[model samples]
Target: MKTTRLAAVAIIANLAFATGTLAQDKELGEAVTIELNAVKSNEGGCTLTFLVANGHASQIEKVVYETVLFDSAGQVDRLTLFDFGTLPPGRPRVRQFSVPGIACDALSQVLINGAHTCEAPDLTDGACETGLILKTRTKIEVTG
Candidate 1:
């Protein structure tokens, strides 16, 4: 009886530790993913489409990311901020930015410099950047 009780306690303790580890992993995996979806060049300039998804439980009222555009020659083309306003939890949003005087083919990579703004009532500071994920469906490489 004593051995059985000790084994049961050990099992329970192991389960508790495993449960806590799983929760931490889940929290770390929950993040905002930004995907560079597409790029189109028109008579004016270029239009870049982005797919933004919020995986957090809280709603983000406003969020802006400073982005650096790199040319095909590996030179900085321009730096600007892209505002992804009102990101609801678990909802993917599409946003577009028009870059005047730059062709889509001229761009080679886009670097997410940092978060310019992250506004949410329930989120702590730096919440937008702490677990941010970057992706790209286009030929251009995206990095944070």
Candidate 2:
């Protein structure tokens, strides 16, 4: 019984080590850049097409982010999630998001609320908001 228990402990330890190293090897990368082209009024509100392009060498599986939209009076109308699932490396993936009850022109500012999960290491502190940048088209930055 003791022998079996010891063997089980050893196996569990090895598995843990392997998994930790694998995560470390993959290496969590940085957040990608967001390109906001144009916002058009849609059925109920407005639709904005944006591109999630690679900002680094690592492959990105998912990007969980939040967006804050300010109305014409600079008041926050709504906050929504912008999850870019499985971004292709070295290729630009265009994604669309619809904001209900909000006009395209009514938006005064759009900010990246937070970076919930980005890259391999996951949960990067302020990586989605403060570290955010607009490479093209939309000049609105992700700050604060």
* Candidate 1 lDDT over residue span 29-123, tens digit each: 55788878778898879999887777788999999999999999999999999998998876667789999999999999999999898898887
Off by over 4 Å in 2: 1-31, 119-130, 135-144
Candidate 1 overall lDDT versus native: 0.82
Check candidate 1 and list the clashing pairs: none
Best-matching candidate per lDDT: 1
Give each model a TM-score. 0.79, 0.65
lDDT by residue (85-114, candidate 2, tens digit) is 766544556678888887787877787767
Spell out the clash pairs found in candidate 2: 28-121
Q: RMSD for each model, in Å, please?
A: 15.1, 16.4
